[model samples]
Target: MSMDLWEYQQDEVMSEYYQELCLSEFQERAIDEFTAERLSSYYVENSNLLVDSFRALEEAQKVSSLSPTSGLIMAAISIEIALKIGLLKPIVFGFVHSEAVAESISNAVVKQTGIDRFKTLLVTLLKEISHVDIVTYKRSGTKLSLWDERGEVQKRRNMISHKGSLSSSQDCQFAIDVAEAILNELLPDVLTSLNLHLQNKVIVE
Candidate 1:
């Protein structure tokens, strides 16, 4: 029932998630190429915000008569934050090598485009920079593409953000699940691939 408890739980979840990802052998490689300082500086704050909003949702769910609007909003923001993190990580990794790419990512960050636009930008950026088509990339070490749309999480988030609608606890929980999947699986994979590509470029040049 407390945000502090929720925060603690969130931290635990992320810590476990990161630990698993590290076992995949991506942690050292990604950090070596991407630079831990840059990634942490660009990501840590928004990542914490994501956890905060998720905690807010959890706290609200404990109240039976409370409006679900706030929870829905938090869920939506969590999705957006995950997407932004996905998009910005590559730029942070590559910025020092390519100012033009960095400038482009900076512009996208300044505009803070919608979720769909952000996805498009992310997909395009990955392909342009690394020839990796993210739309086709599997998530969570599974064979399913990240954009399979089976969960309808983005639709729910859009309804809340753009139309001022609210979702039930079930849907809100589903959205949080989707957020966790993206944060733990999709973003790391994309960044790992990007870092590999950047490292190869460095070697080839």
Candidate 2:
């Protein structure tokens, strides 16, 4: 199929899936290795924060007068962590999708693939985001569509933050699962087009 037609079909299918799941989904999981490394670092950092908060909660439980306030604070922190974790899925998705599109374009032009070329694609992706007008960025360029999706995810994050809106643990899990589905569907096509292998490697900082 033509790129435009394929993208349209992707949108249609993803939209239907999102409606059924009540979650946003991406087309691929083709994140650059560097981006994955950064995200892994972020997860580590957040895990530390979670550990500290849990420790504080444990200490507070031992104190009678401060227990109520401590419990409330811990609950709020837990919710924040959950939302951040939820947000991470889409943020990672955006980076991967953006990088994959750029890589596919560059590989087609050069008829060869290299890690450096992929990194160049990543730099280009970041530059596009940096130079665009904030208000119009979502519609301006090839990778800009990811920014639109990012905005939607941010809105959900806001609801989670201000309204305590995520209904249950299942809701949060669904968000992550949708993210994975989006990546899984899109990444393989991009990799196949580029004649590149998607290896399963642990991305560390």
Candidate 3:
């Protein structure tokens, strides 16, 4: 809890599953009344899911040592969520400017009822809309984007889920790092478009 919020009471529930909220510094930063009025629900939903992806990153790190496979799977899930909701959905909505069209496209991309694969959709959207060619989007000072970024971890997650493949702490850490990097790299654009500031124990930007 960054703000040490004083609660009047407590819920008779498990704190382990509770998620912390980002208390916006609206007092310090002046609110844009006009923009606030025109804000889209797509933006709000995407922002919340992006925050969830980050939260999953932290949870994966926390469990990396105890259960490597679980950690790896969690990190992989975070990557996929960040990819769709964090980057693709917002960018699509930004261009289309119609929530209905955007929602339909987003659902199709995410659901993928054997029409197009999830990974295929992700690459196509990144290349066509965002102009981010992930294949050529190399890591800084290295030609390591081939597997270190997203694909390898996703494959590993599939293996673990379908084939019960065991994983190591190193694998878990790598997945966690990749998930965090992808989310962090794409986060600024989403936040800026939404005209929102983010802060918490895990995220301070």
Cα lDDT of model 1 overall? 0.49
Candidate 3 TM-score to native? 0.62
The C-alpha stretches of model 2 lying farther than 4 A from their native spots are: 1-153, 201-205
lDDT by residue (tens digit), candidate 1, 34-147: 443344344433334235434443544444136555555565555565555445443443433354654443433423445453354445455644565767765455565655
After superposing candidate 1 on the true structure, give the runs of residues whose Cα lies further than 4 Å from its correct spot: 1-68, 92-110, 118-121, 124-133, 137-145, 148-151, 161-164, 191-205
Per-residue alpha-carbon lDDT of candidate 2 for residues 1-205, written as tens digits (9 for 90 to 100): 4569888787566545433221222223232322544433334443332343334334433431343333333343333332232222323334433556533332232222112223333334333332322223332233534334334434554566677764344334323332332233232222233233233311112
Residue 168 of model 3, lDDT score: 90
Q: Where is model 1 poorest over a 10-residue stretch in terms of lDDT?
A: 196-205
Clashes of each: 0, 4, 0
Give lDDT: candidate 3, residue 157: 85
Q: Output the lDDT of residue 139, model 3.
A: 50
- lDDT at 3, model 2: 67
Return the top candidate by lDDT. 3
**C-alpha-based local distance difference test score of model 3:** 0.56
**Model 3 residue 26 distance off true place after TM-score fit, in angstroms:** 38
Give me the displacement of residue 124 in model 1, in angstroms: 4.6
What are the per-model C-alpha RMSD values against the true structure? Answer: 14.3, 19.0, 13.0
